[model samples]
Target: MKQKIAVLGPGSWGTALAQVLVENGHETILWGKNPAQVKEINEQHTNHHYLPDLILPTELKATISLEEAIKDADALLFVIPTKAIREVAHQVAAIVENQPYIIHASKGLEQISHKRISEVLAEEIPEDKRKEIIVLSGPSHAEEVAVHDITTITAASPELDAATYVQELFMNEYFRIYTNDDVIGVELGAALKNIIALGAGAMVGLGFGDNAKAAIMTRGLAEISRLGVALGANPLTFIGLSGVGDLIVTCTSVHSRNWRTGQLLGQGKKLEEILNNMGMIVEGVSTTKAALELSKQLGVEMPITEAIHSVLYEGKDIKIAAKDIMLRDGRIENEFS
Candidate 1:
């Protein structure tokens, strides 16, 4: 039962997912924009730019050409950054007419339009050529997923069967998949939690212990649930794998790009300098802007998101933002579940 799966964007997540598919007996071709990444995956059997230590399966091939990757594929997994989704979708639109089941592993809204990744795909891909849209997200980090470690993730779509199919596609002894129909909730939770992770990393960088990190994580989830609920997603989704599960892993794991980015900033690196140094997508910076915009538009109270926004966008000092949050008037927390 080997199916052809094309994964666009051969960064860490894409490479790891392709590994899972290959191990599961799927023909996975990972498409990378960078020639070196493509060469590494095809020749060296490892994407040195992303997952340097993990070896890729021979069933997993890499190509720089989008046409070669998507041309006769059974499934298409969009593993690119949120900022590049629309542009990349446009590149593949003509080739995507094959109507392969589409899966998105990206977790941020478009910075300019404020549209979710799913929504962006709907706009970029031709309506007549559309297929089932599925989202794969959870607390699973690429670093752990690349290795043979236990990880649980959610496969969500409005269509139950689509979710279940993806769940079966990736599920294995080391990987557990849960099915959910709350696509918006899953996407929103995935996008916004990165912002919270930044805050948690700031706490770590500031020498705040476990108690402070847990509190920040809890409050950060509350903000995510609020905005998600306002936009027609199930509130309870914030309690599940795509929500609280994702928040915990990203906030605590050193493998998280969002958390690491914030840690550097908390250690006093300028935003521009940090971005230049990483040379990869941090995701949280754009997500913070999108969440801040979502809060303003929906009139939701998200002080934590706003605080992070100020630190990242307004050039406010991280310490000043921390003090402001500490001094803000507080009240009893209400469980949204």
Candidate 2:
């Protein structure tokens, strides 16, 4: 029952996922654009650039060549960031004609296009042949996952069979997988929570403790729910693992890039300087821009998202922005409820 999985974009998340597949007795080929990293992974089975201390399992093979990595794989896990997914998808499309069902673990929409990762995949891959697209997402982080820690994630697809199959493919003792039909909601929640996570990070940076974080998380759910409902996602889906569940974990975890990025901002570091030094992918940085545009197009009231956008892009001071939000005219509670 071994699966041939080609994990593309071998970053920390991608490397961790490849590790999981290998540990699960699956044939995994992990590919990266960096030749040095790929060579090291193939030879040493260690991604020194990312997970420096952890040794990759012997079953995992790393490659720099796209053709060699995905040639005979049964599935492709799109683990790249939103900004890089399109180009990688295009490259994969060119190399593989009869390909495996592409599974994406990325968690952001395109900033300029504001398209979901799935939509970006569809645009890159050929449409004539039917493709089974499944998304694996939740609150799991790469660091914990790499260490073989127990974690729960949700698998979603429009097709029930696809979702179930992905669940079977990824489920294991340390890693648990759940199935859901709420693709739109799952995708939206995955992408949007990062922005809110940034907000939560800012709260942490400002030394605002549990009460502020709790308020931000609850209100952030409201923001996601409003926008998600407007975009045709189920209102209640916001309560699921991909929604409020995912939000709670990402906003609070120090491992979160969005939160970390916001932390620097909260500590009065410039966005450009923080981003330049962060090294790893901070998704909420770009996701904030995408959500800002999406909110405008959809006419959703995303106050937190809007505030974060202002701070990140418009150079609005966080202190002033926070004060402005607090000073807004009082409104009836549970208006959406």
lDDT of 1 by residue, 132-190 (tens): 88999998888898887899999999999999989888989999999999999999999
lDDT of 2 by residue, 1-337 (tens): 8888899989988999889888888999988888888889888879877887789898789888898988878888999988999998888888885658889999998978998999889889876433688889998888899998998889989888888888888788888989988888999999999999999999888888999899889989999999889888998889988998899889988888888998888999999999889888888889888888888898777888888989999999998877777787777769962
Steric clashes per prediction: 0, 0
lDDT for 333 (candidate 1): 75
lDDT at position 230, candidate 2:
88
Model 2: which residue pairs collide? Answer: none
In model 1, where do residues sit more than 4 Å from their true spots?
335-337
List lDDT for all candidates, in order: 0.89, 0.87
